[model samples]
Structure formats: structure tokens, C-alpha cells
Target: MVKGIPVSFGVGIARAVCLSAKETQAVHVDSQPANVEQELKKLHDSIERSTAELNRLHEQVSQEIGAAEAAILDAHLAFLQDPAFAGEMKTQIQEQQLYAVQAVQQVMEHFAAIFESLDDSYMRERAADVRDVGKRMIKNINNPEGDAQEAYTEPFVLVAEDVTPSDTISLPRQLVRAIVAAKGGATSHAAILARSLGIPAVMGAGPELLTQTANGDLVIVDGTSGSIHINPDEETLARYQKQAERERAEMEQLEKLRDLPAQTTDGRRIELVANIGRPEETEAVLAKGAEGVGLFRSEFLFMDREQLPTEEEQFAAYRDAISGMAGKPVIIRTLDVGGDKHLPYLDMPKEENPFLGWRAIRISLDRIDLFKEQLRAILRASAFGKALIMFPMISHVEQIRRAKGLVEEVKQELRQEGIAFDEAIPLGIMIEIPAACLIADALAAEVDFFSIGTNDLVQYTLAVDRMNERLSDLYSYFHPAVLRLIQQVIDASHRNGIWTGMCGEMAADPLAAPLLLGMGLDEFSCNANSLPRVKEQIRRMSYESAQEVAKNALALSTPDEVKTYLASL
Candidate 1:
């Protein structure tokens, strides 16, 4: 058995099919100075062909899946068009007299390394994107007619050192039962695409996967538990075969609930929503039966670019989301850039304790110009549909008041300019800081709603760095203190006649569902893939039972005790 990070949830049993690592590995090829111009031309032509391929893949993925998943190809296209990326390769070929393939390999590896070294996990996953583009460019350079597609005659588990987004998307979905990679994390584009495509996937399994597993070896991939069993004993195989069938049945049952309301047996209806980063994701969100979008991460618009997004650009993105939801409320979180999430264009100072330093609401407050631009754009977009504003990492009531003041200023400016917008649009703040949780009541009075960002809340409440692998056990949403803080925020919101929603991993957790429901959480927002399962869990229990579970859970002494208690239910 091998342990890995589970990116997509499911169970699969199939014969192993190992993808050759040599296909992705770059080979060095030295060229002569006289052939530099020719090498450069080859490089340019390869990029053009890669661009066309990505464009076709983007359209294909958009049609097969949704626009959000297809958007992953946009990064590949961006890299192909990026002067910095192509120009670096051109320079390598011209100055170092290297072949186009070698230039691509070297320059891409250099960029991928820079991304891998970043403090941010999301940015680190981008290293895969860089390497993926390089592979495509190399392939196009070698075979301009395009390499023949691999034809799979039987269903098999795809084992690779790592799979790229393009490769994952281009795969024959019906024949690929699951994917097990020795590299990659949950945030990699490949993982994201797998989840979007509803395929079982286990990533970051380490190098042992390729070494130990052979082609035609029977493999059991328990993606939910991140366990891989290679040529398992008869007893283990039988147990997993049963589990796989159960998983399939459960998936079919969940699909039936997609169009149903997320209501408990006792008739309490919870607003089930999805957390999305881009406008294109709205299609996936709605397809999963999300009542609305609880968190539209506006920071994505400000990232992977050379400059701040103009008001019109921001407005267009927000408008697209609002329009896509077709009047379902869309809560747009303001620019929460700082800490691990850095923008190259923004002049932010490095801090020793970045998480505790200038970040989120702090940055927005300090940079009034950037804040108002986003607010104005959001407000203008509000006129098209039900749009709300949310501020993240607020430690006190002052931050909420100050942020609200700027929103008012934007509203006034829009009014003066005679622009149409929803004057009564709701305002909300993310209760992620321990300080904010303690003063929930005070903060609750200032905002129309509260969305607890438990990812950071768990970190701040326990003083645990969530990104630290060594301390992962200490970083849990099931922690007693974390649960109490969440309860406190929910209670405070209800007391003030405002609703509370959670847009974090905890919200999607089936084990945490009953406890949150019993705590009277008004809304549940998670990734689109988890919506059906979460809703199914809610539909299975009565509100009274969930409340009882919550009561028992709150009395628990430790995270394990709480989890054990929830599991027993």
C-alpha cells in the first residue's frame, strides 16, 4: 500500500498502465552558432503550433466539461504568448547556441523552479503548468503533424510521474478508470481537471509508485483515502471491489439529488453554494445544483498578470459571474492579496510572519485606490444581478467599518456619475481571524452577513501554519477551539439577524456537516464536486439529530474525540 494526496474522491480497480517518464523528460541538444536563426524559427513555429493545440483543447474541454475546467488551458496559452517565456527560450537558443527543444527545456525548468520555491502552495503547483507547456512545445517541435494519440483498448489506472492539464484533458476519459501520479498536489491543474471531470485520482504518491508498480498489475485506487494497493491479496481485492461498487451506487444516488433542495428530514433548508475563483466556474457551480455562489474569489482577477485589472475589466468578470448565476446571489470577496498570495505588480514588503503581517483587509485599507476600483467594479456589476461584497482577514470591527466606508465612497462616486448599481447590495466579511471570532457580535452588527473562512481560522485559532507538513495533524477544522469559534460566529450572526455561511474545506466535509447544520449554519459553500455529497448527507438526517450531534461534539475534549464522535453518528 502506498499513501498519496487524494485530489479527487472515488474508488477504482483496474490493471495499471504506466506512462513513460521519458515522454516528459527533456533532453539537452547543443546547436551551432550558424543554426541559431534556424533554431529560433523552429522555436517560434513550435509555439504557434502549441498555441493552436491549446486553443483546440480549450474549446474541446469547454464543450465536454464546463468553461471553468477548460480555463486551465488558458494558462498554457498565456505561457505560449508570454514574451518573457518565449523570449527567454529564444535568448537561450541565440546566445547559448542550443537547440530549440533544449532551450525550451532549460528555460521552462528555470521558471518552474522559481514557482516551486514560492511560499504559496497554489503558486507552487504552477510549476506543473510550466513543465506541461514545455513538453507540448517540445512535442510540437519534434512532430509538427502532431504525435499519434495513445489508444487504450481496456480500462486501466493511469500511473505516471506526473500528468499535465493538457494531457489529462486530452485523455480518453472512458478508458481511463483512474490516475495515480508520483508527483503533483491537490492544487495542480491536472488534479483540478480530474476533479472537474469526476475521475478518481491519487497524486503525490512519490517515486516508489513507478518503481514498484508494473504494467498489467492489478491496482486498487481508493482516492477518498489516498491509498493505492498494488496486486493486493484476495481478501483485500474483494473488500475493495465491494467498496468500489458502493461508491458507484452512492455517486448515482447523489446525482439524483442534484435538482433537489438541500433540506433536512425535519424541513430545515440550507442554502448550498459553491466557492469559485473565476467567472467561468459559474457553469460548474450551477451544474452541481448550487443555490448560489457563496465565494467569488476576486483575487484571481489580480493574479498572473503584469498590472492591476482595470475597473472595466473587473466589472466585466464580476458581471459574467452574476449573470451566469441568473440572479442567485454572488458574494465577491475583495482583493485579498498578501501573505502567501503575491502579485508581481503589487509593491508589497516581505514580512517575517507574513500570515500575521500586512494582508487581506489590511492591504485593501492601506491601498484605497485598489480597493475602490474593485468596489466600484463590483457595485456596477451588482446592477446586473444579486451581487454581494465580502472582505477577508478582518481582525476587528474597525476593518469592516473602514472597508464599508470605502464601499460607500464608491457607491457615492457611482451615483454622481449616474451609473446603475444595486444600492441595497449586501456587504459581508470573512471571519478568519481569532480576533474577529472573539468580537463576532461587534463585527456582526457592521456587516450584512458573515462567511467563516475556516482554512485560516483553524490556523489562527491554534497558531498552526497550515502549509507546514510536519504540523498537519495540529492543523484541523475539527479542533475543539476551531469548532467553538465557528459556533460563536454563527450564533453571533443569527443574533444580529444576519446569516452565516462557511466557504472553506470544513464546509464540504461530510463529517463536519451535521455539526455545522446543528449549529444553525445558514449556508454551506464548497467545491462544486462535493456539493452533491454534502447535500445528500444533509438530506439523510433530521435537523433535530444534527443539532444533537452538534451538542455532543461541542462537549468533546479534543479533535480526535470530536472526529470519533462525529464518525460514530
Candidate 2:
């Protein structure tokens, strides 16, 4: 009778001790004046004790959600120490005739408002963290009973209207069997964290979930299937328990293969690269045997928060990511935010079709100062590791030329400052737009590499939005035009002595593996988890066989022919 998204599979018979993040605290403030400073001190001391714990939470989450996201609290540590933010709070209470607690509350909400309105989910989550720290501080001031972080002690499932990144920090990990939420789709940070932690989670159950389930009731969750069951009987519970154990075992078996090489039977090799958001993610890539980072989306540095991150903040992130790779290649893609990937700092107007609106390099060029600051950060970080500078959504030769000019300008400035950098760092462009693919040969001569963004390429080529499940079937990476465009890019890159790689979902598909192998792609960078299976397929065939299949397939006109060829293989 309960409704909620079921993120994980399996059933366990246990008493429910529900821990909901949306539950608010009354946050009593002591009335004594000079005595209140003593209480405020007690609260500050509580915050001080919790700081170390909060940081540990940050690292635990970093392990699950990438280091960059984990570092959100890292900046908060600095804010806690900030004379400006702290001084304003004290000033509001002492000089403006506001209560000490109200002063902190107002200060926090002021900052929280800036983040909550931002277009970036990463940034929006920070508002929740600010709220978290603020409320914790208030609880500390009040010396509330049984509020010692671990209020939830028994094994149970956590259901919430929504789960913010901060909600996971101290959520009684030992007690939480799985996560179920009424909101959040796949791209939400909550879903991403659940996936990383291998936790069963269901999201987007809607308002119906509010009343269906209650505390102290047995429930079943199937994360893999996204199903939830209320008051599942003994037989059902036993069956789901088996399913949970089996799936957990399978996941463990996969983890062991994390660092193994991804090579095909015939000796064709493909790169297993991690898609990351920050410099800290390099550690995960290295642990997973990622040849390198294929996509380092830099938008997190720009989106979700009030103002753009300082150059030093951005530089540290970039430097850490590259350094974490330990001399392995790190392809850094600059701000790919706008449209659906919106950043609040830019104040971009709402559009009917954000996908077709100003995004990626289009926004970068429009705000040259922000663009140049990023270039400087990349160049500065280049001294720390093997960093490749890449531009996204490039559609014209002039755009490439102008971007190169900015890079040159940044390099010149660095040279004047005597900073070390890979001035010869490879510059690559994403072949996503239809125009860029059509002019592949011309573009090939200008850039160091070409990475097929098949997600966008297929969307653009087929005139379908891949995000729209209704139009998903129409989104074919094997369309004749898509194949011919890929061929053009590959042939042109080979001709120009530049490398061509595929970083899109297509690169991970076993069926597309041989076709790409034959077409002569220099690198096949894909999700780190898919490496072995794709490698096994590549090992089964030779370069010549893949080439022939690719040739024959390209000559065919339909997606069915291409799929048939792959299936026959």
C-alpha cells in the first residue's frame, strides 16, 4: 500500500526507524544575554567537535560522488574560519539588536537564497548543506537531547521527499539498508551517489509516497527494478532477501575487475576512462584502472553556487585532478553548462529549447573574461600533470581559431610570469554539432584530436532528444549519416596525423566496438565499468575484419542493417 521509488532490490525483516531529512528542528534559543554568549560558545564548541565529523562525511561522500563534490564542504571549512562571514553574524546580533541565534539564521538564509536559486544541481545542493550546518549549530546552542548525529540506530530504509547531497553525510550508514525518495530523476546527485555506493535506490515516486508508508512498518525495495512494496509478507521478504544477496555478490565480482586491462581477443585495445567532475576524481579513475579521464566536466566549478569559483579554487581543483592521474592523460573539458546544463552565475534566460540554445563554447565565447579565467586555470594546473585542453560544442573553423588565440594569449601571460605549463598541451574539440561533423576534414587539420560525443551527435543527427524516452528509439547512433560523418572524422584525423577518439555511449557498446575498431579510432574511451566486456569483443576480431564490417555497414542505409551486422558478429 506504500508508494515510493525502489532504488535497490531485496527484502529484509526489520523494525523501521525512519530517518527523514525533510523533518525540521524547532531550534530553541536560550534567553539569557551574557549567559547566552556562554550558550553560543557551547554551540560553537559543538560545531567545532562536529567539524571533524563533517569532514569525514565529506570524504565518505567523495569516495561515493567524486572528490569535487566531496569538496563542497571543503570550502565551507574556509567559510567557517572566515572573519567576514562570522563577523557579519556577530555584528547582526550585537549591533542590529537581533538575537544571537536569529543573527546566524538570517546570515545562513541570505547565503542559502543565493545557492537555491542557481541553475546547477551541484550548487543547489550546497544550500541544503548550509541549512544543515546552520541547524546543527542551533541544535548545539540549545543542547538538545538525543541529537548526537546518530539519532537513527536500527536497520531501516530512508524515505524522503528528496535527498540532498548533505543528507547522506551522517545518515546512520550502518542502519540504512537502502534509499527511497519521492523525487529526483537519474541525473540528480542523489541517484549518482546511490549508484556509486552500490546502494539500492528508487527515485521519483511523487507525492503519493507521503502517506502510503509509515514508520515501524516492513517494506521491500528493488533498486535494480525501481519497485517498492509495502507490508510484504514473510514469503515475499525471503525471496527479496535472496535477490539482494545475489545482486550484491555480482556487484562485488565486478569490482574485482576494476583495474584489469580492457583488450579484445584479437588484441585490439580500448581505453576505459572515468567521467569526472573535479580534480579529486582522478583517484577513482586510477583505482578503476582508467587509462585516463575522458570527460572532466568543468561546469561544477561554475554552476549551482552564487558567484563563480575563484581562479585559485578552480586551479586547485584542476591541478588535483591532473596530479591524481599520476602522469596519465587527463582531458579537461571547459564549462559545458547552459540549456539543460545551466549555471546560475551566467543569468541565462529561460529558453523553450535549452538544448538548441547558447551552451558550452557558445557561452564561453560570449563571456570571454570567464573563458580566459578558465584557460589560465588550466594552464596553471598543466604544470602538475598531463593535462589536455579540450573545447566543447565547436561548430565552426573560426570558433576553433578564436579559442586557440585565447589559449595562446593565456600561454603568453604565463610565460611572462615564468610559470611552467605544457604550452604544447593537446587541444581537442568535441564533434557533437552537425556542422562540426560535416566539416570534419577541415576541422581535423586544426585540432589535436576529435572525440565523438555520440550522445549529442546521435541527438543532433537524428533530430531527436535522447533525454525524451518517447523519442529514444529514434535516437540511433548507426544512422547512415552518423556513420558517414564518423568515417569523415576518422579519415580526416588519420590524414592530418591527429588522433580521433569516441567518448560517447556508443564507444561502450560491444556491437559498435568492431565498427569503431575498423574505422581506425585512436582511442575508445568509455565508462570505466564497461571496459572488460567491450575489450573482450575487441579481442575477438582483427583490425581488418572490423574495418570491412564498418565499410559494409556504412554502405547500408538503415539502423537495422548496422545492428544486424553487429549481432551477427
Candidate 3:
């Protein structure tokens, strides 16, 4: 059995179909091409062919899956049209006298290497996109007749070093029961596509996965637990088969509770919402029975592109999300860039400790013009539906004042321009920093609501890097210190007449649901996939019992104690 990170949840049992990485590797040509013009023409023709193919794929994905999933292809298309990308290949073909295919391979690999060197994980994943496009163009140039799509006569588990976004979309959904990759994270475009398509996936299983597993080998994929078993014993296989059936039964049961309120047996209600990055993701949020959107990660719009998204572009994206929610409150967190999310277009300096250094609200405050543009877009989108603006990583009261001041300025400008907007759109801040939680009352008074970003709050409080695999055990949201801070923030919000919502991974956890509910957390926001189960858990217990659970949990000395106690209940 091999362990990996679970990206999508489901159980898959099938024969392993290991996809070789050799095909995607760059092949250099030793001899220079005699005809430079002809080589350039081949490169240009390949780009055009790849572009047309991508267009067809975009339409097919939109019809079969969703517009949001299909939008990834648009980014690929942008790369094809990008001067830096194509022009760099042209330079290699002409000056270096490299063959068109060889130039595409070399240039794409060079760019992918640069992306992989970046500190940010999200930016590094983009290296796959660069390679994906290059592979498409290479295939186009070599086989103009078009390569035949791989057909599967039986369901199988796709084992690869890493599955690209295009490959993920192009796979026959019925035949590919699960995906087990040697590399990738949950946020990778391929993983996101898998989740949207409801396929089970376990990524980053390490190099051993490729070496040990062979085609036709029986594989059991427990995506929920990130476990992969190759050629399991009969007894083990039977147990997994039973577990899979049980999971299917539980899913059917959860579906019945979709329209039900996330209310305790004693009639205490909590708002269950979803965190979305793009407008099209609102479809999954609503489908999962989210009462509203708790956190709209607007930073995604800024990343994976050449330049900052214009005000009109930002406004259209925000507007579409608001419209999709259909009057349900949508909280849009403004531009939380820097620290793991780097924008190449933005000339940010290299930082020693990025998380502690220039990031989030600090960057926004320094670049007020950029801040104001995002504010204008959010406010403009508010005119269409219920839109609320939230600022991230605020530690001091001055940051809140400065950010709110900008919002007011944008509102005034919109008013003078005869634009319609929600004048009373609720403004809020993410209570992530330890300083923010300590003075939550002061911060709460300045905003309509507070959303506890536990992911950062835990890391900052424990002085642990959440991304460090070695320190993962130390970075627990269930730690007494983290819980105390969460309780403090919620208590302060109530004291200041503002409600507090939690938009973090902890919100989706069933173990934490009872404690959070008991703490009087007004809202619980998480990934769309986890919503139904969270709601179901809340509905089963009494408010009084949850309160008692919270009291006991707060008294616990360690994270393990808290988790153990919660599990017992």
C-alpha cells in the first residue's frame, strides 16, 4: 500500500494502466535545419492546428462538463497566442537553426523549468500547462492527420507521473474509474478537473508508484484516505469492496439532506456556504446545497496570466458569480496576492520569509491603484446581486481603516459616474493573523462580519509553516491554542454585534463541526464536495450536546486529546 494526498473523494477498484512519461519528455535534434523559413512555417502551422483543436475541446468540455472546467483551455489558448511563448520558439528555429518540433520542445521545457523554480506551488503547477501546450503542438506538427484518442474497453485506473489538464478532460469518464499520479497536489488543474467530474483521484504518490505498478495489475484506490493498494490479497479486496459499497450508500443518504437546513435538533441554525475561486464554480457550490458563498478567492483571476485583469474583466467575472448565486450572499475577498501566490506581472521583490514579509493587505495598501481597481469591480458586481467585500491578512486596525476608506472612495466614484451598486454591501476582514484574533473586537467593530481563515491562523499561531510536509504534524487546527483563538474571535464578533464565519479546511471537517456549532459560529464555509456531510453531521446532534462538546474540547490540553474526544462522541 502506498500513501498519497487525496484530491478527490471516491473508491475505485480496477486494473492499473500506467501512462509512460517518455512521450512527454523533450527530444532534442542534433542537426540544424537547412531551411529556416520552412521550419518557422511548420511552427506557425502547428500553433494554428493546436489552437483549432483547443477550440473544439473548449466547446466539448463546456457542453459535457462545465464552462469553468472548460475555461482552463482558454489559458492554454492564450499561451499559443502569447508572443513570448511563440516568439521564443521562433527565435530558436531561426537563430539556432533548430527544427520546429525541437524548438517547441526546448522552449517549452525552458519555460516550464523556470516556473518549477518559483517558490509558489500554484505557480509551479503552471509548468504542467506549458508542457501540455508544447506536447499538443509537437503532436500536431508530427501528425497533422491527428493522433487517435486512446480507447478503453474496460474501466481502469490511470497511473501517470502527472496528468495534464487536457488529458484529464479528454479521458473517457466512464472508463477511467480513478487517477493515481506520481506527482501533483489538490490544487493542480488536473485534480480540480477530476473533482468537477466526480472521479476519484490520489496525487503525489511518489516515484515508487510508477516502479511498482504495471498495466493489468489489480489496483484499489481509496481516494478518501489517499491509499493505493496494488494486487491486494483477496481478504483485503473484499473489505475494500464492502467499504466502497458503504460509501456509495452514504452518498445516496446525504443527497436526501441537500435541501434541508443545517440546524441542530434543538433548532439552532448555521449558515453552510462554499468557498469558490471562479464564477463557474458557483454551479458546484449550489449543487452541493450551499446556502451561499462564504469566500470567493479572487486571486485566481490575477494568476496564470500575462497581465493584471482589467476592471471590466474582473467586474464580469464577479458579476457572473453573483448572478449564479441568485441573491445568495457572495463574499469576495479582494486580491490576497504575495506570500505563496506570486504574479509575474507584479514586480514584487524577493522576500526571505514571504509569509511574514510583504503579502496580502500590505501589498494592496502599497499598491492602492491596484486595490482600487479590484474594489471598483466588486462594487460594480454588487449591483447585480448580493456581494460583500472582505480583506485578507489584516493585523492592525489601520489596515482595516485604510481598506474601508478605499471602498468608500470607489463607491463615491461609482455614484458620480451614475453606476448602480449596493450601497450597503457588507464589508469584512479575514481574522487570520494572531494579532487580528487578539483584537477581534476592535476589528469587528470596523466591519460587518469576520471570517476566520483557520488555515493561516493555525500556522501563524503555532509558528509553523502549513506547507512544510515535515512540520505538518505540528500544524493542527485542533490545537488548544488554535481553538482558543477561534473561540476568542467568535466571542469578540458577538460582543461587537457582528457575526463570525469560518472559511477554512476546518469548517469542512466533521470532527470540528460540533465544536464550531457550539461556539455559536454564524456560518461554516468550505469546499462544495464536503457540504452535505457537514450539514448532515450538524442535523444529527442537539445544540445542547454540541455546547457541552465545545466546553470539553476547549478544556483539552492538546490537539490529539481534542481529536480523540471528538471522535469518541
Give all candidates' CA lDDT scores.
Answer: 0.86, 0.72, 0.86
Highest TM-score scorer:
1
User: What stretches of model 3 exceed 4 Å from their correct place?
Assistant: 26-38, 49-85, 112-133, 147-149, 185-197, 277-284, 299-320, 340-359, 367-385, 409-423, 458-481, 548-569
With a 3 Å backbone cut-off (N, CA, C), the pairs that clash in candidate 3 are none
* lDDT by residue for model 2 (292-402), tens: 888787887775467889889899989988888888888899888765565555788877577788889988898899999999999999999889988999999999999
Sort the predicted structures by TM-score, highest score first.
1, 3, 2
Better of 1 and 3 by TM-score: 1
**Which 10-residue span in candidate 2 carries the lowest summed lDDT?**
4-13
Error of 3 at 428 (Å): 1.1
Better of 2 and 3 by lDDT: 3
Instruction: Give the Cα-based TM-score of candidate 1 against the true structure.
Output: 0.87
Listed per model in order, the count of residue pairs whose N, CA or C atoms clash below 3 Å is: 0, 20, 0
lDDT of 2: 0.72
- Per-model TM-score, in order, reads 0.87, 0.65, 0.83
Compose the digit string of candidate 1's lDDT tens values, residues 147-228.
6456688999999888888879888888888999998766567877888777899988999998999999999998877899
